[model samples]
Target chain A: MAEMYSTPHEILYYEADVTGKLSLPMIFNLVVLSSTKQSVDLGVGPKFTHENGVGWIILQEDMKINRRPVDGEQVILQTMAKEFNPFFAKRLYRILDQAGNVLVDVDAFYTMVDMEKRKVARIPQAMVDAYQADQVKRIPRLAEPTKFEEGMEADQVQEYAVRFSDIDSNQHVNNSKYPDWMQDVLGADFITSHEPTAVNIKYEQEVRLGEYVRSEVKIVGNTTLHQIWANGTLSAEAEITWTEL
Target chain B: MAEMYSTPHEILYYEADVTGKLSLPMIFNLVVLSSTKQSVDLGVGPKFTHENGVGWIILQEDMKINRRPVDGEQVILQTMAKEFNPFFAKRLYRILDQAGNVLVDVDAFYTMVDMEKRKVARIPQAMVDAYQADQVKRIPRLAEPTKFEEGMEADQVQEYAVRFSDIDSNQHVNNSKYPDWMQDVLGADFITSHEPTAVNIKYEQEVRLGEYVRSEVKIVGNTTLHQIWANGTLSAEAEITWTEL
Candidate 1:
């Protein structure tokens, strides 16, 4: 079995943000893309795409950031399976700096879906075999959700529209982008102190081309919960927490 | 005259970077898009796009960042004609925070090209007339080409392929991405400290879809000068100076 699956990524200019720091949303994006590449290398290649008309639907994700990284830092993104079931697969990610410092840790849960039907499908057998063969070390799932209640007041709302650029390879709003929606309502000040420690989302609907969604947030105790509604329907609900760095 | 064309842009999730801060590339992108929108607002509206059968080509850019803004900060992007010649047009931009703080100041030069002839074309009279009528606080051309020195030592050459994602609506590497390539050879550390005080680049070639361009860079004194070459021909070149913040 392979010991670990790792990919080296060069921080592109588009990726380096104005603060000269890598933005969190872009970090999540790179992680998702690198993870997809890892899956392909494991021989579960885009088998579902252009052939079986299948793709992975992100049910939820919880990520924690230790520190912000700067632009042009060559980063090594390492991802591995934490656990798998008939319907859901959980994966964990570690982002390492050049000197092997862990910059961020991410845990996400995804379910396979039939694109044509847009419904959750059983995990393909080939994928299960590939995960078993993947050499990456299996890590434990994150213990709990992120916290955002200390300074953030509850019952705030922010609205966003899906643009042409938001669609990814599968033509749906990329899963990594949802975290951005969460950050939008929280404002920049909140993002400064708290990084996403855990993100748990339930995807009940899909957002397509030219649609708009409203993020309604409520901070309950230590938990900052969000509900994303599209055209008055609950598309997804998320509960996240932020930790002081 | 349409009082100093100001464009309202909705921040997209894809544009949120790793730091959860908006990326420089995306800001640069919005500048270009807003500039064009200003032209469309003035009724110039890309007639040259159909006439010359070639679109605008960014020859050089100089962007100064005073502060970095984060996601969901709705700001106004104001653009105006600073100067133009028969061969090229220069534009200036101001990115304001919601509270009216100047986040960034940018100046750029672009030339129309005749695609079939593969050469720069004369600026259309209609385009020039439209922009000249709507000038706002026109500052003297921000670029001082005389400050740029040529013929320096060379050290390393790095190459990058233009991916599908790299292309913008204009169908070239989004003009903003060129700065990333410029920074790639400079190393992330040097680039972060050395805010671009001034820049001068000349685009001589177009990087087609899926073409790889090699970047050759040399650091001399306080300036790092670099060039992008494609198929053994020079595509663009820039000279940047480190500024004290």
Candidate 2:
């Protein structure tokens, strides 16, 4: 079993929506940040990776939410390096309440990229040794997010100019922001009236700096499928399952 | 001296910009949040204010930055209720490193708003007593941010759509976002090339939910003045003095 690392977090007010629960994007960010914390603990964090001319990039994630934490709530994020292949790695993250009640569960996949060439690089042996990542011949694949239903029209489309704040230290749009761009098309009323139960997001291409992205959502009943288009290219796609609040 | 409250915070990656320093808006948010923590410690947090039919709204702030904290750094937010008159209260905030070196200092002014009436209200006695605020006869006025020079045109204008996530619990755009709209006009290169040494910002009106905002900026030498207009009404104004990186 891989060793686990845990970090304490407080849900800041700005992270919560009108429903008082952590916004979807913030939820994603917290989980991803937990993994980063784990990487830091393993001595394979951004500094180490960047020094070696490579950096980790998240390509996909699937998350299940038991309940969303509200504003000013204290939560524990637990993460571990699960397994990896020659080309990819898989990590697990769990957000728990003070009493150890699970609030969210996620399985995230990552790959290392060469900073200079912007190409996927082989998983470094030093990282594997540091994380004790189980060396598997092939990493298992997560289920693809479901596509839009037949004849489904775009329920709503929202345009956003990627602000400088949207960029992260990785010089790319952070993974958490994709959900905001996607779900924001649902509007304020819908956001307040429903809670997300499950979310699956896949990144096809990186959204660069200062690029305007159009987020389109097609709602078929309680499940909304979202696509973020940047200049006619699909940047990211997501599917969210929601239940009435 | 007013009662002081101190809280510890870790700088998250998202809060850091390309320059590896905390974003200007985030610095403002942190200091303001420090005051909120003080309020909570005094048992007059959002819950208490909401139940009492009143809320604290920041009207203006002036900040001086010795240095901006970098990501992954642990810092302490120190705040205290300073002085107040019948309608306005002035507070002081400091962000310090682990070694007790000050990174940023701010003076913030606030007023109570009657949520039901959507109007400024008298400062409640209970809060004043709880915080042990000195009842001063008047709050000293802050220096106004300088207006544009003669015949100066807007250096750049950027339009933004108010997203669902932009609205805070107060049902209006959060104060932190105003600096973002103001400074993003400087573009990514300028942001990375310079650091803000001083900032003075004031609010004239609130930007309601879903309202489009136009941010205009005029740069004179190293100082940039900004105005945020929502449908031809000035919502906020600011001036930032920048130093070369």
Candidate 3:
């Protein structure tokens, strides 16, 4: 069996939204935490990468929610290094209720970049052996972000000046903030009245310090196509499916 | 001894700022999580209060950091209901390093409000007993938020439209976001180079939905005073002391 890690997590109220459900940003944080812990256990943690003059980066992620965990609810978070290529790797994560019913499923793609050259680095064989995950020669396909229709105009546009605190350990805007910047533009009326059912994100560029990004959203029914633009470039694109509360 | 609760928290990458230390907001979140767990263990969690038609609120908080915990560091979070009056209570929390040295100390003031009447409610004696904490006849005095020097005009101001997810379970802006909105206006240069040594905050008014708030900051040497204004009223005020990194 491939190596796996799991932990019990209690959804703190501070992590919940006005609807008393786990917010999308926090859901992303918690699932990432699970994978991080797994890496640490496998002995290829951040420190390990830093010592090797490399850094981890996320390229894309897809999330499907059967049900968002609620405040004060205890759930089990599980993650494993599922598949890998010489250039990229995929991690599979799931949140399970007490009854073992999966509440959320996520597939995240990651690659290591050399700190000095800033180029994608080959996956180390020893690191893959630590996790007991399969090494594949082919790159795994990630779900494409929701596509925008021709001549479709954004229903709403909001801009956010990046916060100093927005810079995470990566020394750049954290991946979790992307979803917050994307969906929050939907306005309070739609946000508080709807729940996200699924989300797909593709990270194209990193947000720089002191840069203000504009978030534009096109809504049609329950599916919303979103984009985050920084420095006049499309930094990220996403699609989210929601259900009315 | 009062009924004390403690938990181990590993500072994750998402929780750290660019400085590699725990961000002010995440520190607040972790300490609050410890206290929340204590309340749940005492059988008086959010559910109990909701069923009793009441809600918990923070009036003020003061935090002093002897040293900030770094990324990937494991620290012990301890909290206990220290003192209480008929209407207010004080919870003392400490974050300790593995060597048992205190890294941060915080004292938070809290009171419950009647959900329907929307007024401060008297503390129930039975509830106090559960914590095995002291009850005082007089309201406990708290450290006032740092007083501003007269004629001090804010050097910088940033406006933020309240996000839909910024509202927590209370249906109001989360107290943690107040610090983020405040310090982020210091810009990337100050935030990446200076580390906060202490923070004092007083929450006066709650922010409303769809309202754009302005964050104002005045810096004099190592101290910065901050304010959050919504609807042309001071919603929150804070003072932070920093040390050059």
TM-scores, each model vs. reference: 0.49, 0.97, 0.94
Question: Can you write out model 3's per-residue Cα lDDT over A1-245, one digit (the tens) per residue?
Answer: 37668988888777887888888998988998887887787789877888888887898889999999898889999998888888898999999999999999999998888878878998777778888888888865897986764357889999888877777777778888899998788887788788888999999888977899999999989999988889888888899999998
lDDT of each: 0.64, 0.87, 0.86
> What DockQ does candidate 3 score?
0.73
What share of the reference contacts survives in each candidate?
0.00, 0.65, 0.85
Off by over 4 Å in 1: A16-18, A133-154, A192-202, A220-223, A243-245, B1-245
Per-prediction DockQ:
0.03, 0.73, 0.73
- Backbone clashes in candidate 3 total 0
**Candidate 1 lDDT tens digits, A1-245:** 33456887655434533344566567777777666677767767555443767788776666666765764468888888767766677777878888999887877877788888878777777777777733233424434433333345557777765533445556666665566676667654565566555556566577764577887788765567877778877777678767754
lDDT of 2 by residue, B1-245 (tens): 57678999999877788666888889978887787777887888888899889988888888889999998999999998899887999898999999999999888888989999989999888888888889999889888888754346898989999987788888889898999887788898888888899999999899876789988899889999988889888888888999987
For candidate 3, the TM-score is 0.94
After superposition, the stretches of candidate 3 with alpha carbons farther than 4 Å from their true spots are: A149-151, B149-151
Error of 1 at A231 (Å): 1.8
- Higher-DockQ candidate of 1 and 2: 2
* Candidate 2 chain A worst ten-residue window by lDDT: A146-155
Error of 1 at A88 (Å): 2.3
Q: On TM-score, who's better, 1 or 2?
A: 2
